[model samples]
Target: MRHVLLSLGILLILTVSSLTAQVPRRSFLFKDARGELAQARARGEMDVLLVIASMPDQNEQVAQAIAGLGGTVQFQADEVDYIRARVPVDGVEELVSHSAVHSVDISITGSRAFGMAADAPVLPNSEDFSASGILSEAVNPDTIIWPPVLSDYPITNRYSPLFDIRASEFLDSNPTYDGRGVKIAMIDMNPDPLLPELQVATDLDGQPIRKIGVYGTAQDLEEEDDGRWIRMEDMVTAADGQFTYGDNTYVAPKDGTFRIALFHEARDSLATFGGSLENDVNRDGNPEGSSRLFGVLWDEETDDVWVDTNQDLSFADQTALTDYNDRPEFGVFGTDDPDTPIRESVAFGIQIAQEKKLIALNLGSASHATLVVGAALANRGSEGRFDGVAPGAQLISIAEGGSAYGQIESPLISIRDHGAEVVYFEQSSNITRNYLLRDGRLVPTVIYERLIDRYDPVILSPTHNYPILGGIDDFVMARGLIGINGHESKENFFINHGVRVEHDDNLLITGGYGPMGNGALKPDVISPSNYVSTALGFIEGRA
Candidate 1:
């Protein structure tokens, strides 16, 4: 209660401030901004998050000056006292020199690192289904009981001592309090609202619960090359009685370290691009094989290409080819033997772009968001497996992109426009490597601090999966944020699926430890993360 009742709302801001109260306030000097300013100057212009002191006309004058210098105020949080702006590099020094500006740092809009796993496997839901309804192997579909008993999932029930949260008994006692009137906003990647497991029922008031409301504009959606496709006929050339591989313009890797390779549309197997003696790799065995398909592949590891020009299905006979800057096409062979062209494509690009495409198609973040929603409020009705912790809570999906500012902005919009009472963000605000956030004067830190004071919604975020002293970012270190730590369950500990299981409570090995530089614990709470069964998106199955 000591941390509650802030500003206009009543909220419990869980933080380890009591443990860090005695730490001295660190000071920032002009020299601290030198490195960042130099980088901004090199870029010509940059987006900056400025922590400004609450002064009379000073904040407005700073904004005016920034605008006059070819910059725009992107966002402003008066309560936490911060301003986000895109300022020209020539004027960044002038902007930072303002008396009202407390601290200056770059807004990491370009940072792509996220806490959510991008490659989480999409499991088949066939096993969890039956003609009668969706039921797990744990339950007897013939018997069909209502409000399933705890003994069903012998490994770890979705409730008490086994899962360690005790939601079963709590729901049994507080029937009306099972997230009845709450709106939980899942701020993560794209989540399909049509999934059966993620479907919404009704609220406590018996009003038909709306479908999971998807919010936000995906920044990458417009830039995505969804129309980039090559027909197989255009890729194959018939010369010398053998069909040879053609070429396409190469899309260079954004970073010099990587190059992507496009694959042929037809393949004999999923294991490798090459075919066997029994099968035609390029499907060129038939008259219509010329019209197959081709795709783009960019390998971030290497840029060299190796073609099996001899058609023996072995790269050992040939040498690696370079000079991609001059020629983008390679006349690969072995359309006759096993699908050697596919293998050559992989070797040529050094990685499978099609496999990367498959990963993107799977949409791990979407599946992850589905799991998060199901874990909170999945109720199968007569189709019984296990109910979520809050089976009656309303759900919303706020899809976000790579922008750091968009991350916070999405949740704020959810709370304001969609009436979200609880926001579960899948990404961490870890800008420690991008910019130093000393003394909690960073823009994200200030914005989070003020957001809680103004709205007082329950903001939940997972701590970065690192064990360093400052593993938790400075923004999450704000006074009122709830940082969550994922731990291993008894089932996961026994399964021993490569997890180190090395913590006081057998938590995750990569769980971030506490007592940051400011002496505050990184995570305010720990919860079970392993062995969770939830819905998958982009695929018609659940694991």
Candidate 2:
């Protein structure tokens, strides 16, 4: 009964999304879009409209129009007020010229453009030893709690969040709240339910906290015998390195137990760094080096640690570790219960969000997806650490997961339909910088003249440039990485967008492929784009 009521509530809020075309032809068509239109006609297809809706029912109304014209809708969003759809070539002009639409965009999504040339990604090996020292980082080696809370810092990822890691003053206030009735939904790949990190105790109020739903939107996709998406393994590889899926079940290190914690490797150490998997990212300089037996391998059962100096990945080539993995030994870890996907992995991401207090959704692979959400649930910690914000918050992962607004809608629905008080999603698209092609060039335009804004109390990660946190994504996307590109460290700290008030020689930010309107300086606040992130594990064989 509770589940049914919650589901219905979610359906009710979806009314905020309309289902027909109030197409404003001019808003949908590009300036002098003749060439593209002709090309579409020649190919018997048209470029998809990433529609920016202006009202509650507007999205649905416009979608109805597109379907009315026999077009296929790729994605929809009431959260950000937009839809990705492929309209009939012949109906392009008429559709865009319609009066009901506010804005439309032609994707710079091609081989030579902002999009990828191939589906398969070409990236650095993510194997533990691929990048030598970037394989792992020590986690809570001493079992010392970040905020001295036994329950706060217990995630098994090598890089877990500390008490005040979320921000400088985060610990000043009491977590007086435990997300008692709050529900959170992660719209990303499937999470391993078996991960000890995901185990949720009943709310402090004594109300049971467990999954109330599991909605899979990608029902058309094939699945493995375990119900994982047939493409789950491949899509994850497409995400990068040796990642893990299903549930993360890292063994909890007993008090006084030491462990070498490191995630897999990527080309840049920024993507993978912790413990003795040294990339010069030690919290206090010097990395506590291998001779100290701080190199990077942990034998949980034996309480053994090894350092890989030769990088051969064998204990023989390494030094036996007693060095405490050179990491803070703060968190708790335990074997996660055995986890199996209830459905395909991609679809399971959102579903799993429903049952836990927090979830880490990694969307680092899709440029399109990452443009808005890069490893969302990216909880960055101070002093080179990471953890989910609001650790005790309940997670509701029964929604579907994928790119586009449809992926977002599920979680939003979870909020409306369930007890999810907060949803920690990154973003669905970096559509803020979306432009209209005009006079052979792209013109910066705001087509969202008619949509409503979602002011959900969402804990957003500067993770993506999407509007998940309402204005944050637009602000960051407008001026992402002011100084450093993706991987530029400063003072031994991993920085993502390189803005430390002029630290590490990072002084420039990208801007202006098009002109602006209303003349508001974008990126309202440029706090700090640090690389202190919690890892989302989906390793190849960890399952």
Candidate 3:
């Protein structure tokens, strides 16, 4: 009797709701724009706008109209029928009034999507377990937790088991899908090529994965130093002419020849001195040398350390690293400018190695790139433990110019030409909180959609790290884009009942919200990110 009354009441409400339904009303704004673009007119401001044309023929007319409004076309993609330009915010309505303009959206300003928390440290393991492959149970090393904490330093290529990527389980289920032979392109700031984790000795199929192509300045490693900076005061010589500092022992080159590098802190974060290890120390203009170990040689004259910048084995001919002011014409401290300023802190690192190098050069600026790439394809670490999501995929690195805008087109084209099956670009518009323009369009979304239709590569983008904003980043708002959100894991430190405990799985507070402004479900998936212990190629300030 109660159920019947409820059903009758629900039917009555539904019939009344249907009878009183409101008619759909047309929007007051232009078909091509959102309210924000329209509101810009009242403020008399300027903004970067991505204008898409209805037809290819009107591209020229659109360009002319932009020029007439004292606007400059920053990027023109005639092939795609779009142009990105900076026009007066007040003049947006005039530009939209043109018959050929199909849609007007906000342009993106790029920001690296990576960040690091210095307060939380990932420590090394107490023992090296016997493990050698991606499928091995001991792949992620067991960390030490006694004596309060063992060491704060992160281990290179040490993938944390707590931040489970489920690669082993997924591989076990399929057995054949390890991204073998797939070309995965990464476009970020410079990544260290010689990092052992990035290199492949032998993959799961007994094949060696390799970089098919590398774009941008041919990876001028010669200009880049090879090792991390070691403070001069920390160098202590052992009986065998080996250098020992803290827990690190650096063996000298077996052949007695060494290339010493002295780096001074500089004003603009540029190294005071750096040169390719490939320099012909024999003065033969050839790349053959018998140096194995890099050692620090104290200079008596300048009371400062010196580098063999002149390629002579002897340190006599080199000037004091502090004498950059006198060598203005000679490109001091790796800078072509004559006026590079030096800071008080001076550090040095070994640049040449006959066998295996010691500490790898840590590009602190490139940490973001390292994190993203490590999450994707870092091979098993030196211990033969730990593996990335797809350790068998062939890598192609496309470095981008350091700018917020107007630099990614070349990299995109390069990746497309290389036949990349997966493309991961480590950039997001964190500053521009707007995920969907009022008209429900993101510039990257449109561009990526066209690229997907033409080339067919899986694109992965991050839901920006602001959950309060309640939407994914602009790039991930559209179809065919995988928006990844961050989730917490057991590895992250937390306090529970007056004791430190590893937190369980939960959506990271740093993660963005879903169900986008247009009512579309966003953040296609979530991944562990609170603290992922992966490959950190270089050790910084170890002494």
| Candidate lDDT (C-alpha), each | 0.48, 0.34, 0.46
User: TM per model?
Assistant: 0.55, 0.44, 0.52
Q: Which stretches of candidate 2 lie over 4 Å from their true place?
A: 1-26, 31-40, 46-86, 106-173, 178-180, 201-208, 211-387, 396-518, 526-543
Model 2 agreement with the true structure over 3-119: per-residue lDDT tens digits: 999999887777545322232234445432454456556766644433334333466777777888888876565554556667776766665654555554444222212322336
Please provide, for model 1 over 68-132, each residue's C-alpha lDDT reduced to its tens digit, 9 standing for 90 to 100.
Answer: 88888866645445555777666676766666665565544333232324466987677676776
Candidate number of the best TM-score: 1
Better of 1 and 2 by lDDT: 1
Candidate 1, poorest ten consecutive residues by summed lDDT: 341-350
The ten-residue window of minimal lDDT in model 3 covers 324-333
What ranges in model 3 sit over 4 Å off? 1-61, 64-74, 85-93, 104-165, 170-176, 201-206, 217-365, 381-385, 399-411, 435-439, 467-471, 491-503, 531-543
Pairs that collide in candidate 3 are 157-535, 222-276, 252-293, 253-292, 253-293, 272-333, 292-354
Ranking by lDDT: 1, 3, 2
**Backbone clashes under 3 angstroms, per model:** 14, 86, 7
